[model samples]
Target: MAGDGVRGQETAVLAGGPADGMRITVADRPAVLQVTRPCVVEVPFGDVRVDGLYVYRRDLRVDEEPLRYGFDPASP
Candidate 1:
């Protein structure tokens, strides 16, 4: 699959390395898709198809505001 960025924020990570087995299987009889990873199974909404799959990881962090009112009065 071509490496494309979705929502201009998350990028798709093509299936490779040890995580290649990760896949989503759709059952035509029930109209559902199942995401499988090793020993875990997750059923997500929408039509289950290989063409709609894009995988990526996201990391978020929070930092303190320098102008906040808190202070350590006793510190030398």
Candidate 2:
């Protein structure tokens, strides 16, 4: 659900879990990340496909054009 006329924007690519491959619209890419959010999205996993909240956190690596996020299962 990308919007039009987004200023100084870059793609924040969500990795793993339900939001996998999901792109988030955000403000301009900064040299260092300041603002961030936790993944409260729930998804079905395992053989039972029971819905579980799979939190997401930023990957520790060099920042690229599109910011990448990985699953943070420990987050509550």
Report the number of the highest-TM-score candidate: 2
- C-alpha positional error of residue 28 in candidate 2 after TM-score superposition, expressed in Å: 6.5
In the range 1-76, model 1's lDDT, one tens digit per residue, is 2464222222222134233434332121121122234432276547553332323221122122111111122322
**Pairs with backbone N, CA or C atoms under 3 Å apart (clashes), candidate 1:** none
- Prediction 2 global C-alpha lDDT: 0.59
Task: Give TM-scores for every candidate, taking all chains together and pairing residue i with residue i.
Answer: 0.14, 0.49
Give a tens-digit lDDT track for model 2, residues 1-76. 2585445766777777667788876575433322234444466445444244556676648376577777565665
Lowest-sum lDDT 10-residue window in model 2: 30-39
For each of the candidates, give the backbone clash count.
0, 0
